[model samples]
Structure formats: structure tokens, C-alpha cells
Target: MEVSPIWSSIVTAAGGLLTGLAGTSGPLWHQRRALARARHAAEHDTTTGLPNRRALTAAVTRTVRRATPFGLVMLDLDGFKAINDTFGHEAGNDLLAEVGTRLAHLGPPVVMAARLSGDEFALLVAGGSDEIAAAAHAAWRAVSHPPVRLGEQAVPLRASVGHTTATLGISPRNLLHQADTAMYQAKQTGGGVHGATEPGPVTDPPPGTRRRDLRHPH
Candidate 1:
């Protein structure tokens, strides 16, 4: 009957609408999840799961208040280019992940460990220079242990560290720059021991450095 056909068409239309709505919702849900993952990835290192430089800087700025003894450590993977050129970036990335794992085990005082970029990394420590030095030494020794498993081979990764710590007063950016300089000094010293400030030494702290107190926001 004509009436039956009309009813059938109406039912079919309703069904199609529901099906379309359901189908579209699934993809939308997936898309949202994917977007969240992408955002998370953007702020984190894929291999290490550690925060990148941008995130690290923000965290440092927020955490380094007037009362805390803050320190910064700059780390560079020694012989990283050799590994990447001789082996592959895959191997190099794996090595970085392994290093990150070791660093995480160091626990407190090391508030944050971030992969600045590439084979270079940095740590924000909630302590003075001495604490930073101890931690850097530990991290250095930790990385020097038996080679990591890479493509059926044991890949050795070593680190050179430099640290600048301020218990009373130092800006996070300046602390990092000084720490970077210190790490360079360590690299020049053949990558052993800890706490080398310009190795050849005898220069006084900059004119304004001695006057700054970390305990007060300058």
C-alpha cells in the first residue's frame, strides 16, 4: 500500500540519521584523543618522556622562588655524533632514553631533568652548587655504566656535566648560562669528576654576582 511505503521511507530516514550521527561521533572521539596525544608529544621528548626546553624553563621559573636553593646542570652527551654517524639516529635516541631512565632514578633534589634538544640536556636542582655537583657526579657515573642494548649491540653513552647553583639569588636563565659554561669546562677536562668552574680559575665573581641574594626576588 502507498501508506506502508511512506512509513517505510520515514523509518529508513530516521535510521540513516542515527547511523550517520553514530558514525561521525566515533571519528570525532578518535580525533580528539589524537589531538591530545599530539599536544602532549609536542611538550615532551618522544624518546625520554622528559619535558623539553620550553616546559623546563617554565617549570624553573615557577619553582625557583626566593627561599629555595636552586641549581642548574647542563649536560651534553659525549661522543654522541660518533654514535649517530657510526650507528644511527635510532641508536642515538635509544641511548638518550636510557640516559633519561638513569636520571629519573636519582630522585629528589633533582626537581626536573629535561632534554634541551638533541644530545644536550639540563637539570633543575633544588639545592646549592654542592648538591648539584654531587648529583652531576652521580648522573655522570650512572651514564658510564655498562653499554645499553642497541640493535643487538651494547652502546656506551657518556656525559660531560657543568653546574651553577644559587642558594640565595640567581635568575634561572643566568644560572643555566653559567651552568652551560661549566659543562663546557667539564668537557674540556676529559669528562671525569664533577664541579669544574672554568678549570684554569682565578677570576673573581662578576661585580653584581656577589651582591645578589637568591633569597630575595631581585
Candidate 2:
């Protein structure tokens, strides 16, 4: 069979064009996917798949800017150091991940759950005092119940939670500090939920008075 040179050239050029488009688009697609992954990793805690402190700060800032009524709950796991020391950091990490899962699923009136740092987390709640208090108590029960099993060990979890409703003129830092202060107070009183007494702007804890220093020994 004989084919026209011009027709064959047209077909060959079309094939090359399609091949070139694929070669160009494939890397572009992969580059876009990589960028998305980087952005997600930047905003998320790798261990628990929850929003990190940076993301939580951004959320608080946005909420405050919009003048939305909301609440912040700060929670710190009790005796976390003892868990790390006894069962190893792996077990501790596993427990933290489990806690994150529980908090993330707390449902309604609870807007977002974030991991602030090691063994510490925050919940962004929406509503008035009653709603906020309900969410805080629910979070405490969710974290403490049923126990998390790491290998052959069934580990019990306990946390001190401090929650505060946002005020008219509260900065993001002050709001977080207020919640943290309440959490510290809860820790001081043997670990339970505590509400912030100061609804106005608050100061950071004094030097050497960090909450980590107040962690109860197991």
C-alpha cells in the first residue's frame, strides 16, 4: 500500500503534538500535586492529622476580625511525661493521635480541633456559655473514656481543660492566653474543666510559670 507523503506527515505531526502535550502536562500536574501536599503538611500536624497551632491561630485571628462570638478551649494531657517515660515516646504519640481523633469527631458547636504542641490541643467552639461548656465537658469525656490500646497495654487518658468565651476587644494572643490560664488553673486543682474568670484582655504567664512546669507526675 502507498500513502501520500503529505498525509503521512500530517499524521506524524499530530502524534508528536499529542506526545508533546502529554510530556508537558504530566510534570505540571505532578508539580501542582506536590505543592498541594506541601501546603497541607505546613498546616497540619503529621502525627494526628489535625490542624497545627499556626492554622488555629489563623482561625482565631479570622474569627476575631469578623467579630464572631466564639469560644476557645485549651487542653493538656495529664501525666503525659510519665507515659513517654514508661511506655516510650511511640506509645505516647499513639495516645495523642487517638485523643486527636476523639476531639475531631466531637460534632456540632465544636468548630475546629487543633494540636497546639506536644500533648496539648485546642478546640474552637461556637455558641454561648452553655454550648461552650457542653462542648468542653463532652471533649473531656471523649478523651478519657474507653481507654486507648497500644499493643498489649490499655492506657487511660486524663486531661485538664480550660475554656474561655471570646470578648468584644480580645486579641488572638490574649484569647489564647486566657484559655491557657484556665487550663493551668484546672491542672492546679487536680485536673478538670475550668472556665476563664477574666473575660477581658489577659497577660501571658510570668517567666518560669509555664504550664508544662505544672504537669502532674504519674
Candidate 3:
């Protein structure tokens, strides 16, 4: 996929600027939010029309600083490669676009949703443990319920979710990593949702599975 040079430049500049201003005071924080909103296009996925990885990181970082309680849910489709291999990449992409749309309208507690490359997506929400669990389950149902149609092909999609709740003093990277780890566990023990209550070693994706990229927006 040939990305627009304009899009690339905007993302680079905005992400670098935000990362550099990590510890700025008062007015600068407001400026950060303004910059993020103003340049939202730069940080959104062209295929899914959702925030990309960089946007999610910035939002999570800001929430951490405010000591806000939030939840992080990481989702990855199960057996996605088989679908692409059997049906085609176009069908896979269509299914993902539908999944993205469903994720975006989760409403209430879900404050942000983004595609984190490949078949992985993440959701950030304002909530406590119980609320976060409920929200994650709701999202899982949203993704897994309907059979996604790509032309004549009716594809049944299944996704695994890894979720965690954060308070204060936790870095955005740590929060994402913990959730990612739990997500791997979910995939390991038959796809469903897993909560990150205990830390463990990272698990590999299931055997015989090869990762591939499906999005190529020109």
C-alpha cells in the first residue's frame, strides 16, 4: 500500500511533537488536546476509519496523567488467515471494516477505539473493574455475533479480547503490554475474553499460524 506522503508527514510531525511534550504544564496540556483533535485525520486508519495505534497511545498517556480510571481491551481475530487464504484478501478487509464499524458505536463507557495494525484492535474506556468487564463482553458480542458478508461469502468472525483496568502511576506501554499478554492467553485457551489480573510470560500465537497484513490503502 502506497500511503500518501501528506498523511505520513502529518502523522510523523504530530506524534513526535506529542512525545516531546510529554511533561509540559497547564496550557500546553490543552494545546496537546487541541493538536490531537485538529490532526485527527493523520492518526486514523484509512481502511477502518478508526484511530490508529499512535492515537491510542497518546490518549492513554493523557488519561494516566489525570489519574483517571480506564480500561484497555485488545482484540485479535481468530483464524483470520484461513479466511483470507480460502476466500481472498478483499473479503478479509471487508469483514474488518464491518468489525471496526461495530466497535465504534459501543457507546457510553467506551471513549476510544482504534485498529492496532493487522487484525488487532484496541478499545480504551473510562470505567472500574466491573464496568470494564461488562464493556469488554459487550464489545466481544458485537464482533462475534453477526456473520460478516463479503459479497456472496458469509464469513463467521471470532475474536479474542484481553482487557485491563488502570489507575494511576501506570505507563501506557505497560497497560497495553499487559492487555496484549492476556489477549495471547485468550487465543491460547480457545478464543474469548481474558482479564489481566496477573502478569505472566508472553505466549506465542497458536501453532501453524502465520501473520500477514491485509490493509493496503492507496
Candidate 4:
């Protein structure tokens, strides 16, 4: 009897289990499964389920090595501290998870999204200068939608977004730094979006400035 292609594939995948149930493939399968689980854990953020910082770096490095046209966007949530302070840390965590959901569905160009610690997030996309900016804007729009409900109150979401396009010689670190600087600029200019066209100083707002600015309802 000739084995069907489907059965053959299944047997091959199962390490010839059909040939012999007591074969020594259990150890190999266990090893492969363990390695896959470990890799997933290493690459994903525990809280938001987005890519972790190390994964982000590896992705950008691959893009740079391939000399691909890529875009990087850095986003920082506005009023995140106040939410934690008022509603508590649990609410803050919930908000971050929701934000991650929105970013992950940004569609097209955006190949990867990552939560880069705290209230900061990053996006890796493929596009030219204008297309990248559009993707960044779309991401910002998605995050800025709907109020994050906490108990009886509905708190409007807001974030500062900044983008940088990769050039032939630019390193991943430099690209991220540039996007971060532009995000800072956006926050300083009343929280919207900005893009880095050149290298320059990116200063943080005064300690109390964010609290004051974000205190009022949107």
C-alpha cells in the first residue's frame, strides 16, 4: 500500500511515530517545544504582549543589514502617571494592554510593534518618508481614540508620536534616538506628532510641566 502524501507529511512531522510508537523522538520533540517556548518568552513583553526591547533591536538590525527602507516611530503616553496615581497601578496596566491591541492592528507598513518599557512604545514599518509619517500618524490616531474607562470616569487617551526614516548609514540606535527626540518635541508642543529630519538636541519638559498640562480633561 502506498502512503498518501498527507499521511507521509504527518508521519515525518511526528518523527515516524506511525512507524513505531516507542521510537526515540520524544526527547527531540520536547527539546524543540522547549526552545520555541523560550524564544517566544524572550521576544515578547510580559505585560502588553508586544515585542520586547531586545526583539526590537534585533528587528531593526535585520532591516539595516538588508538596506531596506524602514521607518521607526516612538510614542509616549501622556498623563500615564496621573492615571496610575489616581486609579492605581492596575488601571494603568489595563490601559497599556488596550493601547497595545490598537497598535498591533495598525495595518500595512507596520511590520512590528513593541512596548519599550513604561509608557513608551515603538513601531517598525516599511515605507518612504511620507508613507512612514502616515503610518506613524495612523498609529497615533489609533492610540488617541476612545477614553480609557476607570470606574465611573472616562479618561481621554493622548500620546506624543515621532518618526524617523532609515538611511543607508544610520544605525538602529541612532534611528530610535531620533524618533525619541521628535516625540519629546511633540510633547513639548502640546502633544501631537513630529518627525526627525535632522539631528539635534531633544530636551525633556520640566518636571511639573507634564502634570500641569495633562491635568485638564480633553
Candidate 5:
């Protein structure tokens, strides 16, 4: 069959153009995806898949710059070293992942959940003192109950939580320090929740206290 040279030329040109686009676009797409993955890895905890400390610091800085009232809660797992020693590092990793999942599900008021290092974690709550306190207690309940199951073993987790409310003009470092101090206070008296500005009493959850019966400050 005879074909027109003009139409044949147009068809050839179109095919070449389409092939060239695919060749370039494929690599460009892959490069973009790789960059996204790299960014995510940089900002996230490899063990628990939560935001790492660097990301948390950025969030705190942004919140402070906005002059908004918020709360920072720092929590350290009680006896995490023992867990790692007894169950092996794999189990410890599983437990940390479980805790991260629990905290992430705490929903609004808890703006962000981050894993700071080893068994330390932080929560950014969107409110003042009262809201922060409630969020802290809620976080305690989330990790404490429904023991994390690693293989055939059920591991009961306990955390010492300290939280502080922040307003305008507070440095992120100072805010984090306040929460860390409160967490240490809670840790000192076993494990429970404590507030930075509060004094005289700490809400200590008795060992083996049922989740429903655990009392927190009002």
C-alpha cells in the first residue's frame, strides 16, 4: 500500500517526541521520589516511624514563633534498659513502635507525637495548662494499658511523663527543659505524671493499677 510522505513524517516525529519524553520523565520521576524518601528518613525515627527529635524541635520553634499557647510533654519509658536486656533489641524496638502508634492515635489536641531518642518521646499539645495536663494523662493511659504483645509475650509498659505549658516568648530549649524536669520528677517517685509549675504532689500511678482506676490531677 502507498502512504503519503508528509503523514509518514508526522507519525515518525510524534513517535520520537513521545519516546524522548518518556526517557527524560522516567528518571526525573524517580529522582523526585528518592528525594522525598530521603527527606522522610531524615525527619523520622527509623525504629518507631515517628518524627525524630530534629522534627520536634522544628515544630516547637514554629509554635513559639506564632506566640500560641501550647504544651510540651516529655516521656521516658520506665525500665526500658531492662526490656532491652531481657527481650533483646528486637523486642525493644517492637515495644517502641507500639508506643509510637498509641501516641499517634491520641488525636487532636495532641498536635504531634515524636520519638526523641532511645525510649524518650515527646508530645506537642495545642492548648494551655489544663489541656496539656489532660493530654498528658491521656498519653499515659494510651501506653500503659493493653500490654504490647511481642511474639508470645505480653509486655506491660510504664512511662514517666512531664509536661509544661508554654506561651509567647519562650525559647524551645527552655520549654523542652521544663518538660524534661517534670518528667524526672515523675520518674523520681516511681512512674507517673507531673507538671512543671506544680509543687508538693505528684500523680503517682501505683504499680499494676488498672487503667480505669488510675487517678490523675484535675
Candidate 6:
């Protein structure tokens, strides 16, 4: 029997549609895979490639539940804002990236750095209070070593560190808060690093600004 022209046209259209879909399939699959990786990268630190705040918080919660002891260090770059203002943001970003690299080099129990935002960052060390302190000191030294080689004068940087530790006790959030307070105290006492559970108040006087009492601003 002879096929009608309408029937032949319908079959041809169906075949074309199927071929188009088949041609697009590979690209669609690739797009889906790329999106998944992007999502994972967003949840991690851009510089250190460590877990970002979201991931870190989840990990901290798990660590708390498991009663795993760890140390926390909240750090603030001393002259970061000024540095950025003077040189430019590119330089500033480079400095932060370098800091992240240094932290990654320290390894677990030694350092886990995350740029909380701008010149502010945090570190998680898997050890006791003493180890946390030592780590903080080492971090401070590393940061203050010399200016980064950004084709500019050596850009000297210093960090104020606050530290707290728990040997399978206390929530990670609370420990982080304690470290934050200590870091501020370091600022008040005039440059250098400080370690404590609670820092009195913001003591770091502004440049060319002096205070009589160690607690002068108080």
C-alpha cells in the first residue's frame, strides 16, 4: 500500500525532533555537572579552599556533639584597612590570599584559616589551649614577617589573635567567641599578639594616638 504524503511528513518531523534532542544531550549533561561543582566551591573558602562558614559551622556542630577537643583563634589584621586604602584592593586581596596559603601550609591541629570577611579571619586548631596559643604566635610571626612582594615596598602586616581551647568540652561557637574577645584585647595593649579567654575592651589606640593607662581608653 502507498503511504499518504501527510503520514510521510509526520514521520520526517518526528525524526528531526529526536535528532535535535540527541545532539543537545551531552551539553546539558555537562552544564548540570558544572553547576554542581560551582555549588560545592561556593560553600568553601575561596582562598584556602577549606570549608566556608556554612560548612565550618556544620563541622563544628558535629565536633561538639562528638566531644572532640579543639582550639579556636579569631584573628584581625592590624593595618589591613589602611593598607588597602593606600595601595589598592588588588594588593589587599593578594595579601589575604597569601595569608590563606600560609594557614593551609600549617596543616590540621596547626592551622585552619578562613577569611571571616575582609581583614578579619578565624583559625581552628585541633589541640589544647597551649597549642592554640603557640599556633597563634606562629601565625602572628608569619603575618608580621615582612611586606608582601606586590611590586610595592614590603607591606608589613600584623595580626591580633584571640584564642580559646576545649578538650572535648564546650560548643565550638562559644569557644570562637572567647577567641574573638581576646583578639580585641591584643589591639588595646598596643601592637603584638595576645591570648586570653576574655579581652577587657578595645584598647588598640589609633596610630599617633596614645593613652596613659594600659586601660587609658577605659
TM-score of every model versus the real structure:
0.71, 0.85, 0.74, 0.80, 0.82, 0.72
Lowest-lDDT window of 10 residues in candidate 6?
208-217
lDDT value for model 6? 0.70
> Against the unseen true structure, what C-alpha lDDT does each candidate score?
0.75, 0.88, 0.83, 0.85, 0.87, 0.70
> What TM-score, to 2 decimals, does candidate 4 have?
0.80
lDDT of 1 at 8: 92
Count of backbone collisions within predicted model 1? 5
> lDDT tens digits, residues 92-159, model 4?
89999999989999978899999988889999999898888998899889988788777788889999
Give one digit per residue, the lDDT tens place, for model 2 in 85-107: 99998888899899999999999
Provide C-alpha RMSD values for all models, in order: 8.4, 3.7, 15.7, 8.1, 8.3, 7.0
Candidate 6 residue 116 C-alpha distance from true site, Å: 0.8
Query: Candidate 3 clash total?
Result: 0
lDDT score for residue 143 of model 3 = 92
Residue pair clashes in candidate 6: 69-168, 147-154, 147-155, 187-204, 188-203, 188-204
- Mind giving the per-residue lDDT tens digits that candidate 5 earns over 1-218? 88899999999999999999989998999999999999999999999899998999999999988888898998988888888899999988989999999999999899999999878899999988999999999999998998889899898889999999995788998788788778878887788999997444645446644211332222
Candidates 1 and 4, the one with greater lDDT: 4
Off by over 4 Å in 6: 1-32, 47-50, 167-169, 198-218
The collision pairs in model 2 are none
Global local distance difference test of model 1: 0.75
| Per-candidate total of colliding backbone pairs | 5, 0, 0, 0, 0, 6
Q: Model 6 reaches what TM-score against the true structure?
A: 0.72
Segments of candidate 3 deviating more than 4 angstroms: 1-38, 200-218
lDDT of 6 by residue, 1-218 (tens): 99999999999999999999999999999999999999889777775565576766666677678675677776777767788888888877788888877765666576456766556667777777777788888777777776577664777778777677755567666666566667767776665667764334455546544222232245
- Top-lDDT candidate index: 2
Can you list the residue pairs that collide in candidate 3?
Answer: none
